[model samples]
Target: MQTITSARMAAIDTNCEYLGIKRLQLMENAGAAVASAVKERISSGKVVIIAGRGNNGGDAFVAARHLGGYDVTVILIGKKEDLKTPEALHNWNVLEKTSIPLVEFTNSTFFDPSILKNAKVIIDGIFGTGVRGRIHEPESTIIDLINGSGAFVLSVDVPSGFDPDGGEFDKAVHAGLTLTFHKMKTGFLSQNAQQYTGEIRVVDIGIPIEAEFYVGPGDIQPFLKRPAISHKGDAGRILVIGGGPYSGAPALSALSALRAGADIVTVAAPKNVSDIIASYSPNLIVKKLTGEILVEDDIPIISRLIEKHDVVVMGMGLGNADETLLAIEKIVPLCTKAVIDADALSPQLVPFLDKNMILTPHAGEMKRLSGNDVPDEQKERIEFIKSFAQKNEVTVLLKGAIDLISDWLEVRANRTGNAGMTVGGTGDVLAGLTGALFARCKSPLEAAACGAFINGAAGDMAFKEFGYGLLATDIIDYIPAVMKA
Candidate 1:
């Protein structure tokens, strides 16, 4: 019984669209399922559905049409034109043609508590799993009224005012039965959440199981939203801390970060390579360190710089010098979020592995980090990486054919790149892309999963144009196209 979290459910829904299953079809199936579930418990009554403006309300609209022999009425808490999603609004428009009594409550204080007093089976569709923070306005009042109405309550998806992720809120609708679509919520089994969730019912809404185990364009769909009033640095600010022995490595990483939708990228490197890195691209901001390589004296300033950025990319071109690894080990804990790559994959950094960090390592680095050789067989490789990542409580993106990504419990495998991707500097592009996504994604595991998919997809795109002559820069150029939803 794999419980789906709110974030994972969103990914699965997007994958359904990518697989050509229309959103309207899924909503129709969900509404039909709710109608069947309601009929099994209460055959006839003055059924009142308190629907919000989201997709949950759309489900209620569909259910109202199929609830045979029942008097169904819809109470929409917001304006029908102000619906949140396109599918929800479409259903609302269709409901207008039916004879179902439609009651609109636009403001918080207008709806009367007596409206639901006669409800024998009140459907609670006021809020779904998408809500966060405290409950406000007419919805909060509605939650209380539903709890006290003494009606046989049925919640669609999640109960109104209840956190689907299991966090306790101020007020929540206490329902007799809850019909959740697809799979059971991960939080529904929490301590007191079942009290409000009642008898949990998992309904199949026709989403393919392949969508749950694979990575596709749907994984990056959340990054496509950009509010018009958003300012600079709102997208992401990344700091690249590398480039001592190799001049080109840090520049490639910094440039790739900018191409991956990061608003700001700063490359802080040794003095010998700082000017060369800055001269390669005008999009990067280069900061010069005191020494030619990472050293003990640079820890204080690097720590301060780590605090300024949203995410940090460390160890691209910083050769495996003793002093360089030492600097990496010290500065990693200071970062808010990070992508640890290249020469910094020292075994000493194992203690620093956690949910906030992502370690992108090739076969050799994986061997060093785990104190074992890279296994030849696919199953052995997955078990080794999965076990080690779980033990350390960190997200590991082990780079190889059929890239394995794990955060101890859940693992995602990626198969998108070609043999032409076996070139130098391609991994650096992956590291920078991981950094840019880590700043915006919900978790480190999600960012690393997206990184592997996008980086490999871009490599395949470049390989088509250049055959075996694909340069690392060619992959970077195709990233934006692959990232577009």
Candidate 2:
């Protein structure tokens, strides 16, 4: 079971050409799978297939044709003539010959609840992986109607109006089941998709196995699995530094690292907070640093401590100061695998970065590091981050509405995490998770990507129970659940 982003899936579609498979054949298989699943679930239900203008709608069209014997109505949600794909148009032409009632909606006024009042099952094909931005007015209204219909809504591919890679959705269809073809879309497992998607079943459409090698979840699972004969030291050791004014931040990171499968976690903080951190978790080994504020003189002791751990998580709650920045600049160069995050991120520390380091920065942190604001548009931000990561020779996990991870070798997006994760300490947890992964992963880039995905997914699971009131501790509690999923 592999999960891929919408853009990566699109790349796979193109790669299929090399295998002598046309896009139409894939769509046909996808539609057949959806139809088969529907038939198996509800044989006598009146199926309402709500299709859009994209290839996803084409898949629904194919399902409509296969299930034409049943009471099925095909509702096209866009200008029928504007469909871009030849395969989609072909399916549309085939639908015209069927007796299944077909309706078109060019504008918001066309959304009529009466059309779907008799539907026992609704097939959502309104939008697919490529959809971004807020769903338009009529579409939003239509989605709301389908959600409130009390009918079993089966989504074709991914739920329409949801970002397949990652990010919050303005509007999306709530599905009882999501029938995804070939592989699971990354969005289906992301934070935003949880509300809209349920019981995601990946249907094999016979995509070549070799095609998977080109793009997929690139080696992130090693960190999730435990070794059979692993001892405490074998699981990986993590050292977390930072904690003066904001003591809980480093503690949160240390706890998350432990939850993420790190066997040994050590926290090196000011003496005032060392006992406070140790009291939270018995697993933590606290080292009290004798300093009012971290300075360049602390680098020698930090360098010695780095030798005792596999990876170091730094910068959480470390107040931004010239002295702190100087200490980070000196310490980061000495450490092999380090997560430079929070207040530790500064232009002064860039020269110390190497491929072994992971820089976890939010939008504001990224702006400070790069001296340019990340644009609201996801694609633009992804490109900018990729360029920046490649230039710096370090993996950059740019935390935003959609987390984008980039190293010189590859770029990936993690669309996990709910609105509830906006609270403080979550970022600290993310840094801790990354540090733990870095201990097991082959490279810093792989650790950073997996860390973001797992951290955000854990947040999504926490949101199920806690909803809007979720805290960072809730996310840590759900870490195992996300890994099991």
Give TM per candidate.
Answer: 0.81, 0.58
Measured over all alpha carbons after superposition, the RMSD of each candidate to the real structure, in angstroms, is 4.1, 17.4
- The digit string of per-residue lDDT tens for model 2 on 296-339 reads 77777777899999999999888987877788888887888899
Per-residue CA lDDT of candidate 1, range 1-485, in tens?
77888877888888788778988999999899888988887768889989999988899888887885788889999888779999988888888888888988977437777778778899988888888888888788788888989898999999888888887677889988999988989889889887898998998899987677668777877766767898899889999999989988888888888888999999999999999999998888998899999887888888788888999999899999898888788888888799999998999999876778899999999888888998989878878888888798889999988888988788887878999999889999999999998888758988999999899999999999997899889999999989875
